[model samples]
Target: MRKYIGELGLIITAFIWGSGFVVTSISLDYYSAYQNMAVRFLIGGVILGLVFYKKMKHVQKGTVIKGAILGSILYLAFALQTVGLQFTTPSKNAFLTAVNVVIVPLIGWAIYKKRMDKFEVAGAVLAMLGIGFLSLKFSAELNIGDILSFLCAIVFAFHIIYTAKFVKTENPIHLTVVQLLAAAVMGFIILLFRGEAAVPIVDGAVFSLVYLGIFGTAAAFLLQTVAQKFISETKAAIILSTESFWGMVLSIAVLGEVITLKMAVGAALILLAILISETKPRFLKAMPLREKV
Candidate 1:
């Protein structure tokens, strides 16, 4: 039951992030990418801090260190993806970022000396292939954006790995608040350095930013941090990869985007990947038969 709850939390997180795609499009119309990052993180951090002030007061030094590491990695991953998007097609950028689904298990195996689970590995691979089908255009061209996006994927994989490790010893809510605040600081620093620190006051921008800050950044990440406590990092990545599927569904519903055959195939593959990872099927199990006298 706990495990299922964790999985459900991750699914909700993915859905929130998927919904972010549409809000992001709207937000970008009024705010720059850097500004969006800074504002959203700030809003999320403030909200979390206010809501969990008592917990925040008891945060440990080790938790702060772990949270800072996660915060830095999170900022770097988003920075890479945002910059990569400037040079690459959105589809390509998204597909490459989703590569984190595969990298999570590899990081565990290579760095932590953990044994690879065959079902998890297979599911990760299938999820990556599904993302490719969902977002790739088969451009057959390599560029700086592609490289950066790949690097973003690697960083995101680390974020998941470290979040799982850190949550074991630290309070998840405290960790979440600290990491969000740290990320907000980093975003602000970058904005100041770039001389783009001005905040947007437009009503639509405000609404979009607030929605992202609350649901997408704060709630989604808090849920993810809590959920990782109950599931393997690889399985978490497999489930979160469904963000792309949710994005497609929301796009179809909200933006009236036409669904394609490729989208259907990709969504199916992602579902199958989740099923495979969640239920390592055994085909050779014997069935008992009863005879009536």
Candidate 2:
């Protein structure tokens, strides 16, 4: 039952993150990417900072600093995504950012000298096929949004690598807070220099920022950090990749975007590949051993 509950939490995390794309798309109508991200992270960071403060038991002075660095990296990652989204369709953006799945394993290999399993290689090929289908519409002229989305993928890959490596070394909650704060601070600096510091007076825009900050960024990141304690990093990444599935679904159902047959087929292949790659028979074999203990 506890295991199921933890898995459910992770599922919810994926759903929330998946839906973030739609919300962000709507928010873009009223706010620039930098402005929206800045506002959201600032509020989210404050909320998380307060919540995690009470749980801080270790006086390890360097913990906050490390988290802040992680937070800064994380901020750049999302900021790039938001800015990139401005020039790309939500579907295209989602698919591109999802490239982090492929990038993660490669990053892991480069940094940790880890070897790629056959399943992972298979997954990468499937993801690349999906990317080809996704980029079909933009074959002639890849827009700024697409370019930014690709860049975002690389940064996000690094963010995942750093999180997996550092989250255990530092206090999870503290690390979460620092990363949030760093993003918020970075967003603020960008907002100021862009001369867009004026608070978005539009009620709808303000509401969007609040939603993204509190729910998408803060609550989501907290859940991810906590959930990772229970699940392997690779599993967590695979599960979160479901965000693309949700994004595509939401785009079709909520936004009334037409779903093409190519998208349907491509998304299915990618999903099937991720499932096959993630569901290891070895892990299932060990279940009985775990239960006996």
Candidate 3:
């Protein structure tokens, strides 16, 4: 049940993050990518950091170092993804980002000597196919942004696995807070060098920034850190990959967008992948079925 609780946390993280696309779009309209995120994570870090100050104060140096390492990897993931988005179509960016689901198991196999189980390999294959259909264009031309997005997937896979590893010894709250601070610090340095460090205040920007900081960055990452304690990296990635499906649902339900048949099929495949990963579905059962009368 504790494991289930952890999986539940990851699912909620995916939902909050899926919903974040909207506010993120709004926030981006007001500032440059790194500039906006610098503010987002800084604000989030401050809020959660203050609340967890007592815990953070007592944390060992090793824990802070672990969080900083996680945060650095996270910054690379976000930075690459953001820059990639600027250069490519959103669909392509998203599909490429979702490739992390497949990358995680491979990383696990290579780094931990944990071979990919049949179900995980099958699920990753299914998820990749689903993502391709859901988000990729047949004529999707290769470009620098696509390369960056793919690299982002690799880094994100590392982030997921490392977070799982680090959370074993450290408190998730302090880890989450420090990770936020790490990203915030990187964002600050990058924007500082570029001279885009100042952020302007406005109602729309403020609302989006607040949402991204509180729920999107703070709560979502915290949930992921805590959730990883109960789930394997591969299982966690498979579950988180469903965020694309949820994103599509939000598009249709909240944005009044029409669902294309292609999207429906793609969504079905992704759901099928999730079912395959989490349960003993008939799809993965062996051999000939009993004949029906």
Candidate 4:
């Protein structure tokens, strides 16, 4: 029962993360990507830092450095993602960005030598087809932003793998809070380089920043880290893929976006692939232990 509840928490985190696209889109109207990320991570880091400061004493020395490395990867991932939002529609960006589900396994296999079963490969092929359908606009070539979003998927995959490994080694909350701070530190350094450190001060943008900071960045990651304690990393990735589904539903229901048959088919394929990849390995046959992450 407790494990199921933990899984449910991961699903909730995905929902919150999925809805961030629309919220982030709205915020983009008033803030640049660097500015938004800089502010969001800073505020989130501080808020989480306060909540977890007492717990910090419990963290070992090397964990901070490990957290920072993971944080830098995540920072690049989110930065690319937020910047990518500028060139793509919220829904499209949501779908493309969510392709990290497929990317995660590929990265795992490449870097960590984790091998996937046949179903996982099939799922990857299905998701590739889905990406085509989701982003296939006949009228225009894929824009720079769309391309950037796709690249962000790669960065995020590494981030996920690192996070999975690090979570097992460190206190989840400590790592979460410190990583948020590290991302903020990197963003601030970027703002300083861009000479736009003050661009985030507008009163009109505070609410949006707060939402990203409090709900999207801090709350979402906290939930993800804690919930990962109860689930396998691949299973966790599969669960979070639901965020794309929530993004599509919210876009239609709230933004009045039209639902196309291509999208439906593509989404179905991707979801089915995810289901198959996660279930197939465990149920069908046991593989060598070293290949599993």
Candidate 5:
């Protein structure tokens, strides 16, 4: 029961992130990617820094450096994702972003010589097919947005892997808070360089930025840091992979987007793949029956 705690945390994180797609879209109307990120992370970092002020005592030189690395990766990942959504449909961006889950294990296998089980491999294949059904139209030409989203997927995979390693040695809340601050710092530097530091003040933008900063960036990422300490990065990725599914559901239920047969089937396959990753193939296999006397 205790072991499953991390999985629960990750599921919650996924749900929060699922809402991010829509909220971010709203934010993009007011701020450029860097400006939005700059504002979002600054708000998140300050809030968490105040709320968890007690955790600051644990901060160390190593923590600062590690947090900066993680935060930089996070900023890049989120920046690319936010930027990519500009060119693609939210649905496509969400599903393509989830492709990082499949890439995680492959990265581990390649760089660290880590081996993936057969069930995990199967989940990857199923997930790939699901991605195609979810986002691809089998069109002759791919858009720049698709390419950007795919790159976002790759960057996120690195974030997941490195995060898993760092949380083991550092304090989760402290690391997470510093991570936000680091991203904010990087974003500010970018703003300084690009001269887009000034952000418009509007009611809708304010609400969107608050939701994104307080919940999406602060709460969700802290939970991820704590959760990944107990779970394998791969399993965590699989669980969070459901973000795309939640994105679809939220679009249909909240946004009143119409659903299609292909989408329904694709959603089912993605859910099935997640289940397979969690339970493995053996759980889904039927048992042999014996004749009764």
Candidate 6:
């Protein structure tokens, strides 16, 4: 039941993040990328701190250190992706970012000496292929943006792995609060350095920022931190990769984008990847079944 709850939380997180694609498009019209990062993270951290004041009081130094590490990696990943988008097509950026689904298991195996699960390895590959079909434009020549986006994937993989490690020892609520606050601080510092600290006060921009802060940053990340306690980092990465599918659905429904056959195939592959990762298939088993008397 706990495992199911964790899976459900991650699914919802993916959905919320998927919806963020639309909201982010709207917000970008009014605010610079750096400004959006600063304001949304600030709002998210403040809201979480206010709601979980008791948890805030009990935050330990060790938790703060862990949270800061995760937060820094998170900010770096986003910063890379944001800058990458400036040079590359959005589709290529999205596909490259989703490559984290494959990187997570490799990181675990390489650093922690964890054995790679066959089912998860297959799922990760399928998920990456699905994301490629869903978003990639298949450009032959690589550019700086492609390099940055791939680096973003590596950083995101580290974020997922570290979140799993930290949640095992620290309180999820406290860790989440500190993580958001740390990221918010980093965002503000960068914004100030860039002279892009001004906030947009228009109603549409304000509403979009609040939506991103509350749902995208605060709620989605809180769910991710808590859910990772019950899910392996590889499985968690595969589940979160479904965000691309959800994003396509929202684009079709909200933005009235036409769906193509390619999208249908990509969606099916993503669903199959999740199923394979969740339910370890036994087709490769060598042992024969015995008949009961």
For all candidates, the clash counts are 0, 1, 0, 0, 0, 0
What is candidate 6's lDDT per residue for 1-293, written digit by digit as tens? 98899999999999999999989999999999988887888888899999999779988999999999988988999999999999899999999999999999998887888878888888999999998889987879799999999999999999999999999999999888888889999998998899777765988689999999999999999999999999899999999999999999999998899999889889989998999888877873443422221
lDDT string for model 5 (1-293, tens) is: 64489989998898898878789879988878888899889999999999989778768989889989999999999878878888987667766777887898888888877766556656666766676676656645567787898899999999999999999999888889889999999999999999997777998789999999999989999989999999887887877876766777888999998988887887888777777877876753453322121
Query: TM-score: which is higher, 3 or 4?
Result: 3
Q: TM-score of model 5 relative to the true fold?
A: 0.89
Segments in model 1 whose C-alpha atoms lie over 4 Å from true places = 283-293
Give a tens-digit lDDT track for model 3, residues 19-137: 88888888888878888889888988999988887877787898889999998999999999999998998889999999999999888887777766667667777887787888887
Q: Between candidates 1 and 5, which one is better according to lDDT?
A: 1
Model 6 TM-score, all chains together: 0.96
Better candidate by lDDT, 2 or 6: 6
lDDT (CA) for every model shown?
Answer: 0.92, 0.72, 0.87, 0.77, 0.83, 0.91
State every prediction's TM-score relative to the real structure. Answer: 0.95, 0.82, 0.94, 0.83, 0.89, 0.96
What is candidate 4's CA lDDT for residue 293? 51
The runs of at least 3 residues in candidate 3 whose Cα sits more than 4 Å from the true structure, single-residue gaps closed, are: 282-293
lDDT, candidate 4, 155-256, per-residue tens = 877776777788887898998888889999999899999998886466766787899899898998888877777755556666777676677778889989
Tens-place lDDT per residue, model 1, 1-293, is 98999999999999999999979999999999999998999899899999999888898999899999899999999999999999999999999999999999888887788777777887899999999999999998999999999999999999999999999889999999889999999999999999998885997678999999999999999999999999999999999999999999998999899999999999989998998888876741232322121
TM-score of 3: 0.94
Off by over 4 Å in 6: 284-293
* Candidate 2 C-alpha RMSD relative to the actual structure: 5.5
